[model samples]
Target: MPLPNTSIAHALDLADARHWTRQPPKRPATRLRHLLRQTTPSALALRLFAYPHTLTRWAEGDLDGLTPAQATLIEREIYRTWQPEVRRRAHQQILDHGGCVTAQLHARFAYTTRSGEFHDPRLLNVIEDLPALHARHLFDARHRDAADDELRRILADGIGEAYFFCALPPDQQQAALTISDLHLIHFHY
Candidate 1:
């Protein structure tokens, strides 16, 4: 009930209350005072002033006036912390489209995870490994070197559209859904 003494915890509580309860205190320090007023002063003091240690930094003016870069850094940190969630969303996207199909591979290749953490289907133990699912493509060891060569060429050429697709083997290219399929509209002609 009492807001945690930590800044991260306090921010999270504020964000949750703002988003879910639609009740955010008008002033930044109001929650601190409200918590202290409701809870035992000694308990509040112990938690707020003693254990976390950052309170002293705030009191000493060390944590004031955060720069935009600092705020961005914190946001990025929080985003990075949600890698599991990102992976879950990506994995779901893959599964919902028909597992391991050529269309699914194309969709996945074009996908971008917001958190920027790499999700190896194999690492997540998804139903199929990238290579296995694309077996018709790169699983053939004979073509691995050629595939790697193609991938390097595509990357070196600096083509944005081909970045992900270029990484695949010939078989994968053959199996992939065309860009037209990916952007198809259901409008009546």
Candidate 2:
């Protein structure tokens, strides 16, 4: 696959250094700092280190502010870490789209929880978005013997969909299955 026509310099030019500098440090920023220190050239790494908050902001999805070279280096590092088949496909997609593919992949798989930890995308539809009312009903009936004080707590802690389904009465289980099917379709679609 052919690389995108967009030059590294141009991509770097798209970043807004000022905006990144003003943001506070967060997990993404911290992770990006770590990646830079571990993978980037020492001088470039030092330059980014001087603006820790800004680096964090960039890691959190702010493309602006990074130099073209810096962006290229980061992208390369990310690509290098992927499994061979995944890397090949991602490279093809990036070439086909004429830009970065990691961002799209990251967005697809990344689901932030209420507590700020990344949630599994597979569990997102059934658990994360299960309505509080429905969850409460499930807990009251299906999970009656369980010690948890609240349905929300159980869901947040990561209950399996199969367990929840099996606990439901036959009719409710069917209903739950239907609801889950619809949710899965919607999520994948």
Candidate with best lDDT: 2
Clashes of each: 0, 6
All predictions: root-mean-square deviation over Cα? 17.3, 18.6
Candidate 2 regions exceeding 4 Å error are 1-50, 84-189
Candidate 2, residue 11: Cα displacement in angstroms equals: 22
Give the TM-score comparing model 2 with the true structure, all chains together: 0.21
Write the residue-wise lDDT of candidate 1 on 44-135 in tens digits: 44634332234333334455654444333333323222233333444344445654311111111223333343322321111222322232
**lDDT (10s digit) by residue, model 2, range 1-189:** 534422222221222121132332234445465565555444435644436565656766785777756655554433333233443343344335543211000111232323453433353333233333433343243223233233223332223333334455555433212111112111100
Q: How far off is residue 186 in model 1, in Å?
A: 24
What TM-score does each of the candidates earn? 0.24, 0.21
**Which 10 consecutive positions of candidate 2 have the poorest summed lDDT?**
180-189
Candidate 1 local Cα displacement, residue 179, angstroms: 18
